[model samples]
Target: MQRSLLLRCSNSIFRPPPNSHRLRPPSLKRQSAPIAASSGAQLPLTFSQNYRTAPNRLHCSVSESQWKQDREMATADEQQDPRIARISSAIRVIPDFPKPGIMFQDITTLLLDTKAFKDTIDLFVERYRDKNISVVAGVEARGFIFGPPIALAIGAKFVPMRKPNKLPGEVISEEYSLEYGTDKMEMHVGAVEAGEHALVIDDLIATGGTLCAAVKLLERVGVHVVECACVIELLGLKGRERLGDRPLFVLVNST
Candidate 1:
């Protein structure tokens, strides 16, 4: 069975780059989780226990008038997510990114907030606590932010999917098209074993070209890519459609 996830994207990665070289920060120290599970299907999240307050026309929690005002925040996940509002505010969207008029969903805002940063990593661990995830593959380079820590939490190895000609080894490569042009991503052939279950991650999904390429690279090695996890998702671009059959998941989404 496919597992359902509620996402609250952290906005630290979307910050306007001060320097291209310093795009990603250091690896996070592993933290202990208050959970015990080996697979996602085995983990059962109780909705009643997760929601703090009931939704209704009440002043104490949320009033009908207030809900009307916050209509932009009416997605299924946002409505029930305990961390939606906080994470949304943490994500600072810039007016133009890579070009003009493109409001990029940045993760740097969430990275700066210690509370949001840790919560994002910790939350990922909880959701996949039960999945017998053998490896956590982070796409260069933003995926490195949360992927390593989550891997440590679940006792998994951290792997990298880097651009072509970067990894100095016997690499297996796959070519694909990006939003701008053609591109390629490669992984070390020895990095993953045949039949291993891999969880691919990235900071965000826009056109999904890069992710599709990474999935293809993993499949060539006979690795079973159980799912893909990303922090933010820009909807209406058909990003999810690019990833067929693979479980594409996001913490926060903006259409």
Candidate 2:
């Protein structure tokens, strides 16, 4: 059978092997103990039991499964979180922010509200509960505001992917373009361990160029980009299209 096309275009192209499929053990949900292989078969005296084993993944597998299960629970949509709803409603449309004919969704009003700020982080934490995110990489300025606490709540390491010389160390940089201007984002090589799964977090996505650069930087340091989550998506900027198959999770779609 073909890979789930929805999943392909949604999250980055990750099609697990058939054996790795998440399946409910077909039996009864009862106790957790040893049982005979069959009704008539005798249980082995010294059973060679490894309940949940996935090489190089003893830790990763457990974390990933648990997180996914958390996500499977009813998602906390914007309506459910009154704070999120309030924040969404309070987005003041500023005409010509930074340029002509650009009405930016001003988050300053939302940020000042304590409830709204907390809800925004909570929503993001819940949305990615099942992705076994090893690290949360937030961009400079506003990104730092929401990223750290989310990492602490989810038990993931927080790495700051900064702008230009903001990071004080030997860094890996990637230059990308945006609708209004171009800029470069950088990350320290030692921020995250190689092969760690990283979730990129940001306040908004208008062009997606910065986030893309962060992803590339994480890759350069050997981290697999697992997902990208945003607080708000700008109108008509189809940053999602530019992201292709990467997992892009967001709380608000302004468009």
Top model number, lDDT? 1
> Which candidate's TM-score is highest?
1
Local distance difference test scores for all models: 0.62, 0.59
| TM-score, cand. 1 | 0.70
User: Taking the tens digit of each residue's C-alpha lDDT, what string does model 2 give over 1-255?
Assistant: 110101111332222223322122345232223323223343222111111111121111224454334233213443355555555654444433445333445568677777777777777777766778889999776678889999998889899988898878898888876434567888887778888998998877655667777888888878898888777654234455456666787655443
Task: Give the least accurate 10-residue stretch of model 1, judged by summed lDDT.
Answer: 46-55
Model 1 lDDT, residue 160, Cα: 90
RMSD, each candidate, Å?
A: 15.9, 19.8
Least accurate 10 contiguous residues by lDDT in model 2: 1-10
